[model samples]
Target chain A: MKAITLNSFGGPDAFELRDVPRPAPGAGQVLVRVHATSINPLDYQVRRGDYRDHVPLPAITGHDVSGVVEEVGAGVTAFVPGDEVWYTPRIFDGPGSYAEYHVADESIVGKKPASLSHLEAASLTLVGGTAWEALAVRAQLRAGESILIHGGAGGVGHVAIQVAKAIGARVFTTARSEQFEFVRGLGADVVIDYRNEDHVEVVMRETAGEGVDVIFDTIGGDTLSRAPDVLAQLGRVVTIVDTAQPQNLVQAWGKNASYHFVFTRQNRGKLDELGALVERGQLRPHVGATYSLADIPLAHARLESRDSGLRGKIAIAVVPPAHADARQPRA
Target chain B: MKAITLNSFGGPDAFELRDVPRPAPGAGQVLVRVHATSINPLDYQVRRGDYRDHVPLPAITGHDVSGVVEEVGAGVTAFVPGDEVWYTPRIFDGPGSYAEYHVADESIVGKKPASLSHLEAASLTLVGGTAWEALAVRAQLRAGESILIHGGAGGVGHVAIQVAKAIGARVFTTARSEQFEFVRGLGADVVIDYRNEDHVEVVMRETAGEGVDVIFDTIGGDTLSRAPDVLAQLGRVVTIVDTAQPQNLVQAWGKNASYHFVFTRQNRGKLDELGALVERGQLRPHVGATYSLADIPLAHARLESRDSGLRGKIAIAVVPPAHADARQPRA
Candidate 1:
């Protein structure tokens, strides 16, 4: 089985394609013949040695997976061989889904949405789960509330806009003017040109100075630190990115706001919920770009470049499933 | 009317007794003859100019009030003259309750507990509201869950321990060795001598290394930043103290923990809930010391000293009520 293995952490070029032995399913686990995997910020972080102490050298680390079950281990009754599935590979665990075959606890794998191709499924898994957990679970965003999502054109932000809108919330997002149409198409009610406009001023004005009930900060830095400024009393701020700079929480204290630092967890239940949304035509994957199994390094490089044109998640085709035969190279 | 005012931001001696004009109640408000007022950390901060920009100089800065309504303004029907009430005065909105006569919106005052003296009610109001909002509203601690309260013998922490226990949660608290018995008497399931023990290790060992479901951090500083160490996955941390130091949230992200910065909101409903708790004998005020209205400067000095001998909140008797005649001078 061919896999992207990391002998040492450095840059994108450090990912080496090597023939590795296929992983086998253990008790209550399923062996997945991975058809596709996707690039997330976490992947780049792991590849850059951010989690070096937790992740040993000579490790395969890609988190998103869309695959067909190749085998089921003892006590795994929910899924069997040939069943299509999608999931976020367990974090800081043994091996990830960068390989041709990967094994995961059956409880953490969900049936792939029948409406989506493997590439789309892989592209949506991690980002969808992140948005769901941040808004629905952590923030507990409610209907008729207002939400501001930073980085509206990025992987997690785009999905967050859709999720917040699906819950009957008024969605506000920040994006470059060039991506305004793209983000607005994904259900954002208002789009602030982050590069040219002041997000805090716009959010406060649009909310009539009361501020939004929730802020999903996909873009860190000053965005997260100033979230409370555009947050209603008792509002929540959810962020996935980590930075060294300290945020002034004096404002948060005045509003009695809740801050949730989320690193998405892997679970079949969340994936199933996302699949339902996809099947219901309420959520759709935006695969910005796709790469062959051998081109994972190139995908990482492009993702790391912060190119303005890459508007959504990057995907990596591991097995080139039949559904992707006519799929375009870019979203 | 007589009042203690801050003409400057400095030591406890900065407070000066002044003959100030009594304020009349406005619409939907009540004029109260304040009988008792309690010292909170916020009062000290205001005196020290920590919030100089928010609180103007020459301001009356007491936040907790227990008094008899002297008059009700037009359109105010909640309480008339002679009604006993308690409240946490609106923060950063106007002059507080450190004077003999104070005015507050009727919506933010609640009936004083029938069973407690004015001194006791005053001591409990601010601390009770802080504890209630942290555990009940922010943490949403449920029955059978576990919680840890730091500074267990302090004003908010002592009340928090009782509140968590009243909610049927397993309560753990950290305090000095001298205050261990004191906090235990308040229903703390386990009391760690923070000075002699590593709280994280003790808490982890006691919970079988899974950690508590909620941590009510009354003692700020590293306690808040390191709360994730003793927090279970999906746990909540509630804090009232504000700091500029950066916290390493990498661990919190992995645990999916929620951090709430609570500056207790002033509302009559929360005070009513707490009054019920006091009347039911589930929560009690731990007033460590009391001073005459003219001795407010001394009260501030003692509170600022952080003396281990001061076991609970400091109280200032503004205009002693008839019911407070038999009350002790200290806990």
Candidate 2:
């Protein structure tokens, strides 16, 4: 099987396309014939020596993948050969999906939505999972509430805007001037220009000084530090970014606000729910750009540059099913 | 009318007993003859001008009080003259429960329990509300789960231990060696000695490293910093003491632990429910010491020197309901 292998963690060029043996399904696991895989910031860290202790040398780094089950492990009843499934491969343990075939645990694999293409489904899983964990699992965002989703034009933020809107919440997102229209077109009630305007002042004025009900701090830094200034009493803030600098959040104390550090957990059932929402036309992943499997290096470089208004996902088209293989199989 | 007023902002002695006119109840308010009153930390802070911006000065400082209704404001229908009720009086706008008479909105007062004395009932309003808010609102401690309460013998801790147990959750509490028996007697499943032992080590050993489902942290600093260590995956940690030093709390993110800051809101319905719990055999406030109303200065000194293992609340017994007209009502 052709795989993107890192001999020594360094940079984009470190991803060496080498022929490796296909991964086998262990007990309670499944072998997925890779259809597509998506790039996340975690991949960049893993490709560098930054996560040396985390991902062992000679590791395959992709986390999100949508594919067809080629084989089932012992004692597994949930899936079998030819079953179309999607999953965010757990960091370190599972051999990732940046290859011809990958291994996934049954607990973290969801049936791919009928409405979504393999690339779209693959693109949505990881970032969508992150947004779901923060907004739904941690914050418990309810209807009639408001949220300020920083980086709303990014992968997780774009999906989160839709999810918040799906639940009848008012969403305010921060983006560059160029992407403001793009974010607003996706259901953001308010989109602030991060460069020219002060987000706290703009958000406070927009919320009539009461501030937001929740803050999905997808972008952390000085942005996260001042986030609490725009929080309502009893409001919640969820942050996923780990930064060296500390945020001054004392303002939240007077309001009795809560801070939730959300790192998405792998749950197959949740993925299936996400699949259903995608099928319902209520949720969609913006696959900002797609690259061929051979162009993995360029895809990663573009993602790491952070210069583009990449308003959704950066996905790689792996093993596209043939016309015959595309025929309906057991879902 | 004579009232204990804050003539200046400083220590306990700043309170001066002087003549003042009784305040009339506004719309939907009630003026009551305060039979017994209790002191809270907020009372001291307000008198010392710590809350000058939030709470106007030259005002009385007490909050919790049990008293008889003397007059009802226009449009009030819940009670008439002579009704027994208890409440944690609202801030500056509400002339506090420290005097012979105090006024509170009907929305913030509840009928007193028939089973307890005015002093015990007075104790119920603050600590009880705190315990309820920490356990029920912040932590959401469910049956069969485990909860660990730090500083289990303090004003709020003692009551929280019992409340967690009453909700069918296993309760663990930390206290000084001298207070172990006191905490154990309150139905704590496990009592940790902060003086001689490591609470985290003890808690980890008892739970086999799975940790508690919830942590009610009344003592911050080291205790709060260590609280998430004993939290199970997806567990909750609520703190009353504010942490002067910031913590990354990165360790707890792996377990998906959530930290909540509990600043209890004044809700009369919760107070009424707590009153019911007190009337039953489920909850009891430990009244460790008692003082005469005139000895309030001495009482504050004693309260300042509260040691570990002190049983119950430090209460200054005011005009006992038995001597209704013995002293002229302050207002």
Candidate 3:
């Protein structure tokens, strides 16, 4: 099987496309023939040895995939051959979904959404899981409350806007002026241009000086620091980005806000819930740009230089069934 | 009426006895003829003006009181003259309960526990409320879970021992060697001497390396910083003392702990629930010592000296009930 393996951690150029021996499934595991895989910021971090001590070496890059069942190991009764499934591999443990075929525990993987195509299914796994965990699981967002969602146009932010609205929460977003209409189209109640005006002032003034009930910050640093100032009494704030300093404790004591740092773990139950929403047309994935698997270097370069125009996830297309058999992605 | 007042912020000798004008109750208020008021660490902090920004000057020192209702104001229906009540007044917004007659909103006071006398009722208000809020409200301690409570001989810890047992949670406590029997008698499953042995090590060894589900710290400083080390996965740690530095970010995030700092406030619902428990013989107050109303300086002196034998609350008794008259506490 052909796979992208990192011999040493350094840069994007360190990933080598090479031939490797195929892995087989053990008990309670299923072999998946991956059709498509998506990219995430964590993938780049893991590739560069940022989490080297915790995660094992010579790792694969992709964490999420839309794949088909190829084989079932001993005691695996949940899945069968040719069953279409979408999943994220075990967090920092099992081999990732970047290769042609991978084996995973059936308990941590879910059936793919029936409505969306293969690429769309792959795109929804990482960002959708993270956004849902932050808003629903961590914050416990209530209906009829208000939320200030920072980075509302990015991959996770764009999906979060829809999810928060689905849960009946009014959304206040921060982004560039040029993308305000796009963000509003995704159901944001109010949009603040971060470049032109202060987001804290806008949020405070808009919520009648009481601040929002929750703040979801996909962008950390300054945005996370100001989360408490705009938090209502007994409100909560959640951030996905790592803190600026490892020891600088974030205090929201005066406002009675609980600050949570979310590193989204893959939950099969949560993924199944997201799949139901996607099937019902209440949730959808936005793939901003797509490239062939061979053009992964270009995709990585474009993603490293992020800007306002980036609407959703950047994906690596696995030939779309055109160049089959020559180098089958499901090999 | 004669009372002890704080003329300035310095040390224990700053309190002075004086004769002041009596106060009358306003609408929806009750005038209580205070029989006894208990001393708390908060009262000492308020006298030193440490919390001056939150609480103004010229304020009374006490927060916990139990007495007979002398008068009822307009629209006050639940309480009337000759009724017995127990209360902890809101510290900053209202007056303290350390005088001949004190005014409190009807929502903040509750009926006294019929099983105990006035001195016992007064001592139960502060420590009881703190323990209930930390264990029941914040931690939501499950039936089979375990807890590690520090300062088991102090006012808060003594009350917490009974409350944790009442909730069906196993408790491990740390106290002075002399107070070990007292804490164990209050239903502590394991007692460690905080003087010589390390509490965290004892808890770990007892539980076979699995830490407790909740940790209650009445004495902060290094205890708050090291509390996360003794917490199970997804455990909670709540503290009442603010003297600890905020350098425990790593362990807190590592174990995914929910940290809370408790400053017990007057909640009628919570106070009433605790009052019922005391009335039912499920909980009891342990009065460590008693002092006359004129010995306010001596009470403060004893607290500062950290009298080794002190096991519970020290209450100030009203001087010669026949000579006492209705007078509002200084705000």
Candidate 4:
């Protein structure tokens, strides 16, 4: 079984394609014939030694997996051989889904959405679950409320916009001027060109100075610190970014603001919720690029570059599904 | 009418004892002949110009009020003249409760608990409301959950301990060695000597390394930065202190922690909840010291001094209630 293994943590070049032994299903687990996986910021962060202590040397480190169950271990009742399944592997646990085959506990796996191809399912698994946890579980964003989503064209942000819209929330999103129409097409009621406009002024003016009820921050840096300026009283700010610098948050006190810092542990519940949306044609991942298993390092480099022009996720075709040519630069 | 006025922002002496014009009630307002008021950290913060922009010069800056209604303006129907009432004046609105007479909107006032004296009721108003908001509203602390309250012997923390206990939560509190029995008496299940003991180690050991479900931080500084170390997954950290310095909170991401920065806004609902707790004997404010209206400068200096050994709130007797001799060193 060919897998991309990391012997050391550094740049994208550190990922080496090697023939590794395929893992068998343990008790309560199911062996999956890997069909696809995707690139997320967490992958780049892990590859750069950001979480060096958690992932040791000689690690198989991909997270998302969209595949078919090859075998089920003893005590497993949810899945059987040849069933299509999709889920994020338990992060930082044992071997990951970078290989030709992978195994996960039955409880964490979900039936893949029938409407999506394996490439699309892999792309949405991690980012979709993350957006679900941050918005639905943590922030509890409700209908008719307004939410400001920072970096609305990115992987998690794109899913978050759709999720908020699905929950009947009015979405205000930020992107570059070039992506304004792209995000608007995804149900963003208001879109701000983040690089060319002041987001605080746009949101405050749009909301009549009351500010939005929630803020989904996929961009780190000053977003967390400036959240209070555009947040309504008793509003929530949910951020997936783990920034290195300390932030000044004294202003948040006046608004009685709640800040949720999410690293999204894996579970089937959120995956099922996302799949329901996908099945209903209300949610889909925009696969900005596709790569072969051996081209993971290239995908990593492309995603890391500032001018990559990646709008959503980069899917890696471990075993390319049919209709592979349907892949596009955006979606 | 005599009042303590802040003509400028500086040290204790910034407050000047002066004869000022008494206030009259406007529409939807009530004129309160303030019987007693209490000192909170907000008072010192306002005096030192922490909120200088919100509070103008020559401002009367006390918050908690316990008194008799002297008059009611048009559309004010909550109470009549001579009715006993307790509430925090709408913060930073008109004049605060630092003078002989104060005016407040009828909607923000609550009836004084029949079991408490004016000094006792005054001592509990702002701090009690703050603790209720933090523990009940923001944190949503539940039965069987564990909470860590920093500075459990201080003004807000004292009330927070009682509130957590009233909600059936297990309370783990940090205080000086001298105040262990004090906090324990207030229903704390575990008391850590914050100076001599490592609170993180104590909490981890007690909860079997799972950490506390909620952390009420009245002591600022590194508490917010280090909270992730002792917080359970999905735990809530509610802080009333607005520190001047920025904090490192990157560690909070992995725990899915929610941080609530609270500078409590005035409301009648929270005050009524606290009143119910008081009537049921589930909560009470410990008044550490008392001062006459003319001795406010001394009171301010005493509350500010580290060696003053104040355990809870310092009550100012504008028109001292009968049985003034009941004031004690500890209570």
Candidate 5:
């Protein structure tokens, strides 16, 4: 089987494409023939040795997978051969989804949404679960409340907007002027051009100074520290980005604010919820770029670049589908 | 009317004993002839200019009040003259409760518990509301869960222990070895001497490495930053103490932890809930020291000192009760 292995953590060029032995399913596990996987912030972070202690040398590291079950291990009752599945691999566990074939425990995998293609399902799996957990499970964002999603055109932020809207919440998103139309089309009731406008002032003014009920922070720097300025009484701030610098949060005391720091763990429950939304047409993943399995290093470079003009996830086709769906990205 | 006024932010001696004009009740208000007031951490924080921007100079800055209504203004039907009452003054909105008379909206006042004296009731008001808000409202601490309350012998922590016990939670408190029996009597199931023991190690050992479900942090410095080390997977950390410096919270991301920063606001609902607990003998306030109206400077000095041997609140007798109850502090 062909796989991308990281012998050392440094830059995009560190990922080497080579032939590796295919893994067999253990008990309660299913062997999957990988069709697609996608790039997330965690990918770049891991490739740059941000989590060096967790991933050892010569690791096949990837997170999201949209694949078909090729074989089932002994005691695996949930899945059989040829069933399409989508899931985020258990973080920091054994091998991941960067190879031609992947094996996972049956409990963590979910039936892929019928409406999405392999690339689309792969793009949504990791980011979809993160956005769902941050908004629904942690923040408990309710109906009729207003939510502010920072960097609303990015992978997690884009899905967060849809999830918040699906929960009947009014969405306020921040994006560059060029991406405003893209986010606004995804059910954002109010869109602030972050580079050209002050988001706090715009949100406060738009909501009559009451501020938003919740803030979903996908952008790392200073967002956690400044969340209190635009939060309503008892408002919640959920951040998926782990910041390196310390943050001063004295102002949050006055608002009785809650901050949820999320590094989402893999589970079938959240994936099922996201799939329900996808099936109902309330959610969709926008794949901004596509790459072949060997071109993962190129995808990493594009996603990591500051001026890449990327609006959504970068999908990697491990084994391309026979035909492309309307929602699939153009390679 | 005699009152202790903070003309400037500084040490204890900055307070001036002066005769000021007594406040009158306006529409929807009650004029309270203050029998007692108590010192809260907020008092010292306000005096030290930690919140100088919110508090103006020459302000009367006490928070807890236990007294009798001297008059009621138009549309105020909650109380009549001579009715005993207890409440925390609406924070930063008007003159506080340090003076001979205090005026407050009728909606924020509650009937004093018949079992307590003026000093005892005054000692509990501010701290009780704060503890209730942190545990019951913010953390939503449930029955059969575990909690770690830091500084369990201090003002807010003392009441928090009783509240957690009342909510059927197993309480783990940190205190001096000498105060172990004190916190135990207040229903703490486990007590850790924070001075000598590594709280993280003790908590991990006791809970079998599944840390406490909730942590109530009254002693703040680095507690917020280190909370993740001893928290369960989705545990909550609620802090009342505001740190001046920034905190490194990178470790909190993997735990899916929630941090609630609380500066409690005044409300009658919380007071009523506390009143019910007091009526049922499930809660009691411990008055560690007492001072007369003219001795506020000394009281502040004692409360702020590290070696004062303080156990609970310092009650100020603005107008001492005619007879002392067993729960009342001895002057």
Candidate 6:
């Protein structure tokens, strides 16, 4: 099978397209013919040797997958051959979905949304689960509340705006002026031009100086450290990034706010919930770019450059299908 | 009226015993003839100018108080003259409890426990509220769960041990060997001599390596930053100290734990709840040392030294009575 293998961690060029032996399903697992996978920030970090000590060498590092069940191992009763599935591979586990074939536990795979294409399903797996875990499970965002979602045009942020809106929350998001309309079109009630405006000031003013009931921080640094200033009393701040840095919580203490730091886990339950939302049209995947299996390096370069003007995820087509959906993205 | 005032922030010697105009109750207020007040870590921090910018200069900076209502202002129906009461003064509000008389809003004072003396009530007010808020309101510790409480012999930890036990939780506390029996007597199921034993090792070993469901951190620093190592998968770490330093949350993120930083607010409701516990003998005050009103500087020095062998809060007798309770703590 054709796969992108990292012999050494460095830059995008380190990903080499080569022939690799296909993986086999073990007990309670299913063999998947990976159709599409997507690029996440973790991929770049793993490829750059940021997690070199933790990740074994010569690794296939993609995490998000939309694939078809090719075979099933003994004791696996949940999935059978030819079933379409979507999931995020457990991080730092064995082989990843950057290959033509991969194996994953049956427990972590969910039936793909019937209404969406493989590329779309692959694009939403990791980021969609992260956003859902942050808002729904961790923060327990309730109806008729207000929320401030930073980085509204990014992968998780884009999905978060829709999720918060679906739960009947008034959504306020931050984005550059050029992306303001894009986020607003996705059901964001207010879009702050973060680069040109004071988000805290604007959010406070919009909420009558009481601050929002919840803050979803996809972007870290000062935005996360100072989140309490714009949070209502007893509100919550949820993040999936930058927990490595030391953050002061004196302000959070004064407001009695809770801070939830999530490193999203691979679980079939969250994927199933997100699939229901996708099927209901409350959430729709956004694929800003696509690449063939051999062009994995190019996909990484586009993500790292930050000039691709991508609004959501970058997809990689691992296998060509006989009848690709008309909505399938191409680069 | 005599008061201990800080004209400028500095060492304990900076406090001046001076005569000040007696405070009078305003609408919906009560004039409390303060019988006793307790020294908290915040009192020493304020005296050392750590919060100089936030606190008013020439401040009377005590917080916990037990007193008798001398008069009630217009619209104040909660208390009458000679009624015993206990409360925590709001932080950074005008004039604290380190004086002969203090005026407080009726909404923030509660009826004192009938069975406890004024000194005992004063000793428990601030610390009791802190412990209750951390465990009950923030962590929501459930019955049959396990908890680890740091600084078991200190102000907050002493009360936290009793509270967790009262909630039917198995409580583990950390203290020096000399204080192990003391914490155990307060209903701690396990006491680790932190000076010699690694609390994490002992706690994790005792819990069969699953770790405790909640950790109450009264003594901060590394104890807070590394708390995730000894926390259950979805456990909570509640702290009331050390919010100034940057702490890593990488482990917390991986464990999916929640961090709650509590800056306890002054409210009559919490005080009333705690008072009921005191009356039921479920909670008791432990005053390790006592100082006369004129010895405010000495009390600050004792707390700062941290070698005073004090097992609980250091208390101040603001207006010494003719016949003080025989159990009144002495330096």
TM score of chain A per candidate: 0.97, 0.95, 0.93, 0.97, 0.97, 0.97
Query: Which CAPRI quality tier does the interface of model 6 achieve?
Result: medium
Candidate 5 chain A — worst ten consecutive residues by lDDT sum?
Answer: A322-331
Q: What is the C-alpha lDDT of each candidate?
A: 0.88, 0.80, 0.79, 0.89, 0.90, 0.88
lDDT computed for candidate 5: 0.90
The lowest-lDDT stretch of 10 consecutive residues in candidate 6 chain A is A322-331
Q: Residue by residue across A1-331, what tens digits does model 4's lDDT show?
A: 9999998989999999999888988899999998999999889999999889889789999999998999999999988898999999998888887889998999999999877888889999899999999999989999999999999988898889999999999999999888887789899999998788899999999999999999999988888879999999999999999855788888788888999999868899998999899988899888888899999999999888844367778999888655442443344
State which candidate has the highest lDDT: 5
Residue lDDT tens for model 1, A217-296: 88888887788789999999998888446666778888889999898787888898898888889998898888888999
Worst 10 residues of 4 chain A by lDDT: A322-331
The 10 consecutive residues of candidate 1 chain B with the worst lDDT sum are B321-330
As for candidate 1, its clashing pairs are: none
Steric clash pairs (candidate 3)? none
How many pairs collide in each candidate, listed in order? 0, 6, 0, 0, 0, 0
Q: Give model 2's share of reference contacts.
A: 0.33
Considering every candidate listed, which one attains the maximal DockQ? 5
Q: Residue by residue across B20-106, what tens digits does model 6's lDDT show? A: 999889999999999999998988888888778878788888998899999999999879999989999888878888999999999
Runs with alpha carbons beyond 4 Å of true place in candidate 3 = A244-251, A295-297, A319-331, B319-331
Q: What TM-score, computed on C-alpha atoms, does each candidate reach?
A: 0.93, 0.94, 0.90, 0.95, 0.94, 0.89
Ranking by DockQ: 5, 4, 6, 1, 2, 3
Per-prediction DockQ: 0.58, 0.44, 0.29, 0.71, 0.74, 0.60
Residues B147-229 of candidate 4: C-alpha lDDT, one tens digit per residue: 99999998898999999999999999998888888889999999998889899999999999999999999988888889999
Arrange candidates, best TM-score first. 4, 2, 5, 1, 3, 6
Show where candidate 6 strays beyond 4 Å.
A18-24, A80-82, A198-201, A204-213, A228-235, A243-257, A319-331, B16-22, B77-83, B144-146, B197-213, B228-235, B248-257, B318-331
Worst 10 residues of 6 chain B by lDDT: B322-331
Q: After superposition, how far is residue B35 of candidate 5 from its true place, in Å?
A: 2.4
Candidate 5 wrong stretches, greater than 4 Å: A323-331, B16-19, B323-331
Error of 5 at A133 (Å): 0.9
> What is model 2's interface RMSD?
2.3
